[model samples]
Structure formats: C-alpha cells, structure tokens
Target: MVDHKQYTYRVIWSEDDGEFVALCAEFPSLSFLAPEQSAALEGLVDLVRDVVADMAANGETVPAPLTGKRYSGKFQVRVPPEQHRSLAIKAAEQGISLNRLVSSMLSV
Candidate 1:
C-alpha cells in the first residue's frame, strides 16, 4: 500500500471563502479549510494519514497514491477527419510536428 504522504495534495486559495483550502486528489471527499496554506496542507495530510490508518485497521482497501504512479508517456486519440486535417495544417503552418502541436494544446 502506498503511504498517505505520497498522495497528491494541493492547497489553493478560495476566493469565496477567503481562505486556503487543502484537497487530496486521491481522497476527493476530504478537504481542510484554514486561514493559511501551510495549516490547510498540514490538516489535510494529517486527516489523510488518520484515514489511511483507520482503513488499514478495518482491513479495507486503500487507494494508491498518485506520486509513485508511472506513465507510459504515450496515448492514442481519435479525432474526426476534418479536425485531424485542420490540426495537421495548423501544425504545418506552425512548423511543428502534429504530436508537438497536440501536446502543446493539451498542456495549455
């Protein structure tokens, strides 16, 4: 089982709440709201650790952390012919490979 600390956590400021909110992507149901980003992150991580420990005591399956996951860096996408042609033409005009164009688009 992956450690709770290995899970991906993000502390983001909430405009409406006027505070920092910490969220663990692996455990979407859990969040911590705090005045500061550090406190929010710490609260969220502590909750995650407790949750993981409780899950272990109950013999429940724990979620795998995203940090240690590996990606193949390759995937296949199918688009309509017109869209494909347009992308090819755009890539050609930009003087970049179609793969690079698509990668740039997705990154943005």
Candidate 2:
C-alpha cells in the first residue's frame, strides 16, 4: 500500500478564490481547494490515496511520490561570458571561491 503522507504536498493561498490551494508535485494535474490550509492538505491526501487504490485495483502502475528522492547537491549552469567574468571578479573581491559565492547567492 502506498503511504499518501510520503508525497510532496504544497498549500498556497489563492487570491482569486480567497482560499488555500493544495497541490502534490508528484500528481500535477490534481488540486484541492479549501478555505483552510489544513483542510486543503487533508483533501489532497485522501484524493491521492483513492487514486493509488484505484490504480492498484486495475493493475496500473501508480507513480512514485518525490518526497524520498535523493539529490547530489551539485548541478551545472551556463552563463554568458560577460556575466561569468563579472561573477568571477565579484568572488575575488569577496575573497571567496566562485562555487561558494554562487551557492550563497542561490540560497537567497
């Protein structure tokens, strides 16, 4: 049995509807809206559980949730030559490695 709680869920406020919107990144097409954030999250959990059960009953593959996935904490990004030079100069001025400077910028 799939544990719905293991899924990655988000609750965001909706200005147009004046309520909270619940979404699971693993199932992008589905959403649950409610006035309260907790209610929206609960609705999403129930919906995901039902979908998992239905898929299992029909012998369909239930997509895995993304919560437990591992990441390497490293990735590459390309920048224009001018921007790269500027960043390098900035890092030198700060007396920090370019990698450390970029990592600190991204955390913000």
RMSD of 2: 1.8
Give model 1's TM-score versus the native structure.
Answer: 0.85
Which pairs clash inside model 1? none
- Residue ranges of candidate 2 with Cα displaced over 4 Å: 58-60
TM-score, structure 2 vs. true: 0.85
Q: Write candidate 1's Cα lDDT for 46-76 as tens digits.
A: 9999999999999999999887789999999
lDDT of 2 by residue, 1-108 (tens): 678789999999999999999999988998999999999999999999898899899999888877777889999999999999999999999999999999999999
Q: Whose lDDT is greatest here?
A: 1
Question: Candidate 2 at residue 68, lDDT?
Answer: 71
lDDT of 1 at 93: 100
Error of 2 at 76 (Å): 1.2
**All-Cα superposition RMSD per candidate:** 1.8, 1.8
